[model samples]
Target: MNDSEAVMKLILHGGNARSLAMEAIAHAKRGEIAAARTALSEAAEELHHAHQLQTSLIQAEASGEKTEITMLLIHAQDHLMNAMTVKDLAVEFVDLYERMRASKGVEA
Candidate 1:
């Protein structure tokens, strides 16, 4: 795929991952641990895809095949970074929610 197409895919994957992470947090808040875990897994998958794309670009640049810097590419990177941060926090939130449920004598 072209650079623009790859960048768009990165943005799409990042957005999807972020949404899934948020969904996981919501599920955890509702005490639906299984569903929360499922959502997190899906988010991870999306992140994996995005990361692969990013790595390919990095490798190309490292091999002296420079990719032109563009606003869209920067935006895509921002989305990926934000989604990664959210996913990391979502994992913590899910763990906290499980602990809270356990402390309350509710099955986690």
Candidate 2:
């Protein structure tokens, strides 16, 4: 794929990961532990795909292939980083919800 296309793919996957992480938080709020965990897993998968694309670009550069640094590429990187952070926070939120439920003698 072309550089722009690759960058766009990264952005898309990163955004998907972030969205799924948010969905996880919503599920957690409703005390749906299973659903929340599932969403978090899906987000991780999406992040994995984004990371693969990023690794390929880095590898290309390491092999002496010139890569154009564009605003879109930078934006894609931002999305990936933000998504990762959000996913981490979502996991913590899910765990917190589970703990809260447990403390109340409620099963999820």
Candidate 3:
């Protein structure tokens, strides 16, 4: 597949993962740790898949063949970067929510 296609797929996977992670954090805030953890795991799997795709492309490009740069590629790159950043932050949010419940002496 072309670089743009590969990047787009990665962006979609990353976006899906990020969305799931945010929802997981929301669930955690409501004291559903089990559900939150499941969501987090699903998100992580998606991230891993996306990362793997990106890694392959990077390695391929390093072998002397450059992927053509296009607007679509730029867009996907932006989406991927943002998605990854948000997903990482969501883990902290989930943890924070769980701690908030604990600090309030509440049980999930």
Candidate order by TM-score, highest to lowest? 2, 1, 3
Candidate 2 vs. true structure, TM-score: 0.98
TM-score for each predicted model, relative to the true structure: 0.98, 0.98, 0.91
Q: What lDDT does candidate 2 reach at residue 104? A: 99
lDDT of 2 at 34: 99
Compared with the true structure, model 3 gives a TM-score of 0.91
By lDDT, highest first, what's the ranking? 1, 2, 3
Model 1 earns a TM-score of 0.98
Candidate 2 lDDT tens digits, 67-106: 9999999999999999999999999999999999999999
Deviation of model 3 at 5, angstroms: 2.6
lDDT by candidate, in order shown = 0.97, 0.97, 0.85
Q: Report the candidate with higher lDDT, 2 versus 3.
A: 2
